[model samples]
Target: MRPTDIDDPQYFHRVVDCQWACPAHTPVPEYIRLIAQGRYDDAYMLNWESNVFPGILGRTCDRPCEPACRRSRLPEDKPVAICRLKRVAADYRGDISGRLPQIPAAKNGSKRIALLGAGPASLTVARDLAPLGYHCTLIEKDPRGGGLMRTNIPSFRLPEKVLNEEVDYILRMGLETRFGEEVTSLKAVLDEGFDAVFVGTGAPRGKDLDLPGRREADANIHIG
Candidate 1:
């Protein structure tokens, strides 16, 4: 057999199955090592770099990485508690205000972008574009951000404080926000004269089963 090409990106992915499986491709082992070393802030920051909402994801993410963990392949062994570990870092880390990206006081060029729905998708776009000097205006129908996250998820699963902290991090980047304003028409939004518009309004309705008792028990039975 020829020599292994360690420099190849695929090689790293193949070696680190958990990281490869993550949607954000977060460096799992590196963060885990940081956690082990008691560098909670470093680990949290690393996770934030890849996954914007580490605290929220730690609590609510389905954890696709767990199934792909190398430890799971071993007999009588369980996968690392990667998701919980993420929460540990989030909970234990000190203030990170000084570490966040510094948004430029002056806008970059003359482009202005409008983001519809203050959900995770729009928040992510605002986070990315704001630092680069693009003026981002986030419009949401709800009184606050985190569209479905705030509306659907319960307080027990995802505490409001944790959600607020993460959302504030992005908002502090100087992105203009218009809450309690719903966009009824795309044409109307397009006429606002923004250079670009991104719609991230999430699915508001759930698919229901057409069972005999589905409608009868609809009051108690809820679709996820």
Candidate 2:
């Protein structure tokens, strides 16, 4: 056990298991290591570069990285609580309002994109693309944005206020959202002067299991 390893078991494991995790291949250990050292601003920026919803993920990830934690071999029968630790770091950092990580401002006059939907992918694309001055218009038919986030998902599992705050911040960064306007077809958007359009309409249906003689089971069984 090295000097750094003596501090916290969770922190120690996060440093070692970070590299193989992130899909965007971000410097995971570097940011978490920074958090361990109390260098919060740098950690926030480092985490946000690849994953803008750092605060959200910190609180609500399925935590695949935890299973990879080196401390799982310990007697506790659980790995380092990386997700909760991330939430602790983000919570202490206060509001990240208007202080987004620095990126290139020049547009280079590239392609114009019309993104239809305000889900996670749409939000991520908007966050990255809009800063570059790309003309992005996120259209949704619902009264509010956030796709499944605003609806379907229960408030207890995922707090609506937190979701709204993060979504609002992302939207403030120049992602134009038009409500109650459903694009029935892709051709409509392209015809309206958009060079390209990205659709992110997620799954809007659910399936039911058809077990034998289960149809009337609910009606017959009314427990007191």
Candidate 3:
């Protein structure tokens, strides 16, 4: 390892393999231990600080940590329930809505920023900046705020209530929202005099193919 890697605290922390494997580098074992100790509030807050959406990801995260688990490599052993454990913390926490980070009132020095999309990335940016007295304007094309989360993901996997709760919590930052407004021009947004702009235009449209048999009747095929 390089000198910087050696000096980094994560190098030591990485001994807990689950945390090292996580894309967000969340302290998986730390939070799990907290959960086991019945410190649900602390565990949830730790998760919130690390990934910002414990409840949402607890339900729908594609677990990269599981396969990297060192325990799994051991004889007849299984990986810890890192993702699900996060849900245990979120689900059993004493306070529900109160855990959300409060947005500060914009003072004279508040910065005005424009977010190009209302997807997870842009929303996360707003969540971080809003607390620091930034005015966020989320420009979206969809009828509702969530970009692909609401449009693409099946309800069975990620319930609407959970997604909406998290999204609404971020929006509660006094961030202005423009619904049903699709952005086609960047110059127009720049001309409007925003200090900064963040574009998080999520995945493009799904593939559409024109197969042979030419509009055969009695075929009920769905594209998505």
TM-score per prediction, in order, is 0.90, 0.76, 0.84
Tens digits of per-residue lDDT, candidate 3, 1-224, equal 54556346578355666777787788887888899899998998898887878888998898888887777899999987778888889788876557667766653276789999998899889888888888889999887777788888899988888788778878877889998898999999999899999989966755656778536732675555
In TM-score terms, candidate 1 sits at 0.90
lDDT-wise, the better of 1 and 2 is 1
lDDT of candidates 1 onward, in order: 0.92, 0.71, 0.82
Best by lDDT: 1
Q: Which candidate is the best by TM-score?
A: 1
Q: TM-score-based ranking, best first?
A: 1, 3, 2
List, residue by residue over 122-196, the lDDT tens digit for candidate 1.
999998899899999999999999978898899999999999999999988998999999899999988989999
| Pairs clashing within candidate 3 | none
Candidate 2 residue-wise lDDT, 8-67, digit = tens: 545534565644454544455677788888877677777777767666777667777777
Candidate 1 residue pairs in clash (backbone atoms < 3 Å): none
In candidate 1, stretches whose alpha carbon ends up further than 4 angstroms from where it belongs are: 1-9, 209-224
